[model samples]
Target: MDVRPAAEADHASILAIVAPILAAGETYAIDRDLDETAVHEYWFGPTHEVFVAVSDGAILGTYYLMANQRGGGAHVANCGYMTSSSALGKGVARAMCLDSLDRARQRGYRAMQFNHVVSTNTRAVKLWQSLGFEIVGTLPKAFNHPVHGYVDSYVMFRAL
Candidate 1:
């Protein structure tokens, strides 16, 4: 898959990838009730740089990179990833993550952090660990999973 900066034409595909995941309420700690306009704003806003993973003219996934915090914390990067449901288990997420790491390094970020990874998402946790991130902290009962009730959330980090 080829990973590159997202363009206006990729918005629809990006929406398709993120919509199902956001609606499921199984992993990300976001409001499932968000409307299309708000979702677009949250993903495409100026706060971050968005990218898409494509192959055979199809967008398989998308991710956004931004500073983890403002001012003193700007050296650390943060990112959110979403893959097309049809592309799961196909390494799309892994490719985007690797690209994000390279992009982070190119942008002079000193570290990358995931603020709230739901503990129940083992696939993602394992993939992230394999890619060099570590669970630096865990919040007790931080994520209210739709089917699993409350679950722990992790703060994962790694140097770029």
Candidate 2:
């Protein structure tokens, strides 16, 4: 798999990966009916550094890294990742995360944070933990999962 910075032409593929996840309303805290324009703005806006994981000329996963906050908190990085349903369990998400860590370090970030990891997404929670991120805080009933109703969310972090 090749993970690299996303080019403008990759926008369509990125949308393909995000659409189902967003529509499911199971993990990310986003509107289920968000249009392509809004999705584009959120994922590929000027503030984000977006990347794609490609294998055999197909995009299988993607991620975006940015400052968790401005000014005083700029040293901490925040990221969002998504893998195509077909690529799950194939280590695509894990690879993208490792790449993000390296990218964050290269950009001088001192830490990496995931502000709202859905607790019910056990796979992600475990992956992040295994990758050295700790669950520093939990927000009870923070996410309204489509299948699970209200669920807790976690704030995960790790120093770079």
lDDT string for model 1 (1-160, tens) is 8999999999999998887788898988889988998788888878889999999999999999999999999999999999898899999999999999999999999999999999999999999999999999999999999999999999999998
TM-score of 1: 0.98
Cα TM-score per model = 0.98, 0.98
Write down the lDDT of every candidate, Cα atoms only: 0.94, 0.96
Per-residue lDDT of 1-160 in model 2, one digit per residue for the tens? 9999999899999999998898888999989998889888878878999999999999999999999999999999999999999999999999999999999999999999999999999999999999999999999999999898999999999999
Off by over 4 Å in 2: none
Backbone collisions counted per model = 0, 0
lDDT of 2: 0.96
